[model samples]
Target: MTTTTTARPRHDAPAQRARRGSTARRETWGSAALLLLPAVALLLVLRIIPTFAALSEAVPLGSERSPWSNFAYIFSDPSFWNAVRVTLIFSIIVNPLQIALALALAVLLTKRIPAVGLWRTLILLPIAVPQAVSAIIWLVLLRPDGPLNGIATSLGLPTVPWLTDPTWALASIIIVCSWVGVGYWMTFLVTGIKEIPLSLYEASALDGAGSWRQFWSITLPGLRRPLLFVLVADTVSNFLVFAPVRILTRGGPQGGTDLLMYNISERAYTLGDTQAASAATLVLVLIVVAVVTVQFRLLPGRED
Candidate 1:
């Protein structure tokens, strides 16, 4: 008797709810657009504009006789071809070397070891240092009379030329690059390894699987995506290597370390050939695109 009649359900409740949802969606879309605007604007200003500008500079607009003069100049130059060869060799060596070392370090550090955090921090310290600064530090260390040579001398080993001989110069550059890259790539693999469930490892252990067996079966499969990312990024960065080449080698020791980027810079700044530089820049971009495309096709992903 005391219970009042329940209020009649609002007839327009669903309609009101639909209107609220629509408003919320509109707000969400507006917020997303606002957040994306800055990034879009910067991309246009920095990347797109510069690419088009380089294109414009590369082509000889005034001459119908040779529209491809800049490209022809680049192709005919021995320096350009040398740069291309060096770049390819560098990619072939550095990409696999860095990834392999990184994988090894990642597996080692992920184990329950003493001072693991300290070890990781020390490895990653190179990344925190700017590339130019890192290059300078390496420059000192690699000098003929520097600490590295001194150590070799103390061990009664001949002090080999680190940056003064052609082959040794290229190797020195590779060493510097790997030193910087290994830790950075290792961090990514570590993150990938940690994502794997602990139960899987325990199950493998219970099944009498050794550490090597578990790594091959579980760790490698789990790391496919991360490995792909590291490979592509490492390839691109190695192709674009200029700082160390500039500060340390200067594409010297008989042009053995003349990477395409340093070659392009020499053309642009040192030699005052912007047209050839632009053409070389476009070539570099095309090479990167082609290599990355091949990587995407060849490498298996998580979905695969």
Candidate 2:
């Protein structure tokens, strides 16, 4: 018996193409995940595992529940509280100073100034130097009889008690940190500034905006996202700063520069109090998170 044969519609081609396209996307995703696996594994192993380990040490995780004595001890300790204040103040002052200076440099370098390229290279030299090295150099410069004091003596200016006094010690650390960090941060600002369309500036200028007005209306608004990132990241970085304090004042003449990281190290090593150290470290982490969250709330919207 002859059966009537019907041809398949041309819509079959589109269905087959759709299937191939889906398959291709799956392959692409598979390849991407394969490429990302190593980084994810390393981060989990190095960062996440150690973080949890520290948290466990601080909070006590065993067959039986333990009292939160670690947290209690750290919270009650006056030095730990002082460290908290010093850390917050350091971040408060240094982050703004660094951002302002970096933003200024970013704007300045974008202009047609003589030897501007060389100036940028010079400014970045401190960033290339290791933080430890930079700290040591500042230690030399700021010591009682160092070049800075010597110059002051020659010029008959009052020399700063940079390291010996509690008041000046923290300020000295902030100055050193800003010196090393501002140029590094300026690079980010420069990238953000460059990403801003020149057309915006031109349109503003045509509408009778002067340089200051343009900066406020155009440049500042355009840079909101970068400023937010810089603000948050800088605050975190400054909070965790340790090496400069360790090298310069060892957490102080009187705990003036007793920042959270330095305080944690002192607890861990000098006092042989690992539990307290872990607790303090966790507190530091919490403070950073809280401050950053506040910054996100306070700053201009990221989407804009």
Candidate 3:
């Protein structure tokens, strides 16, 4: 009888503890939502709303107006196709080269070397410079009478036109773009490499696996996810490349460096044809989405 009375007195204890746990959970979730709300709101205002508005402008509202008319204008225009071709060529040439250079630099940096911090800082320094500034610097360096051609003349080598010639203008832009982008991409690879478990490397070493073999088996496999992410992001950014073309070449030397963005801007602002520009913009977006979809479908995910 005494033990039963004592057990009955503890009934409120369980209820109080449950209430405290529920309150703690509620507070944690509420705090998380509070922290996330600002960023979510900013994205909605800046990106989501503008994107939808642009799309609406691109497509017609009633049967009297159809987006096809605008699209037809874009498709029939030779310059539009030329710009598309140029953009595709630029992306094709630069993307693989950039990835290769970044991967090589990442591997080299990961090795046991002196002054690693200094090397990393130097590599990353380009990213700190504004894109416009970098383009201007390249423009100066590549000018006909600039340092590059001057060196060529001094060496008694025929001076190759770096930017003025149509043949060389797009190539020059690609070179500058790759130079500016490699460091940023390499940093991602470096981070991914660092995340690989050291135990795997140790085991491979114990098995007398050479550096190349170890990298192919362990490092490459570990880097797959980061590599995919970088490829997707780089592809998207490269497709929309505008700064270098605008500043260095102005899509000049016979429009050899004209990209989709440059073309769209010319239509929207310079030519005063907002509707056509909006339609072109929508098409560009579709192309990027398709490319990304294809990439993901081809790569999917890590096998093991």
Candidate with maximal lDDT: 1
lDDT of each: 0.92, 0.87, 0.88
Candidate 1 stretches with Cα past 4 Å from truth are 1-41, 302-304
Ranking by TM-score: 1, 2, 3
What clash count does candidate 1 reach?
0
Worst 10 residues of 1 by lDDT: 1-10
| Shift in Å, residue 101, candidate 1 | 0.4
TM-score of each: 0.86, 0.86, 0.85
Highest TM-score: which candidate? Answer: 1
Model 2 segments more than 4 A misplaced: 1-39, 63-65
The better-scoring model by lDDT among 1 and 3 is: 1
lDDT of 3 by residue, 1-304 (tens): 1112123334468777687668767777887888899999999999989988987777767859665788888999988998899988988899999999999899999988999868977987887899999999998999999999999999999997898888699999888988889999999999999999999999999999999999899999999899998899999999988888889888888988888899999999889998889888988899999999998987775666
Candidate 3 Cα RMSD (Å): 6.5
- Of candidate 3, the 10-residue stretch with the lowest lDDT total is 1-10
What is the Å distance of residue 130 in model 1 from its true position?
1.7
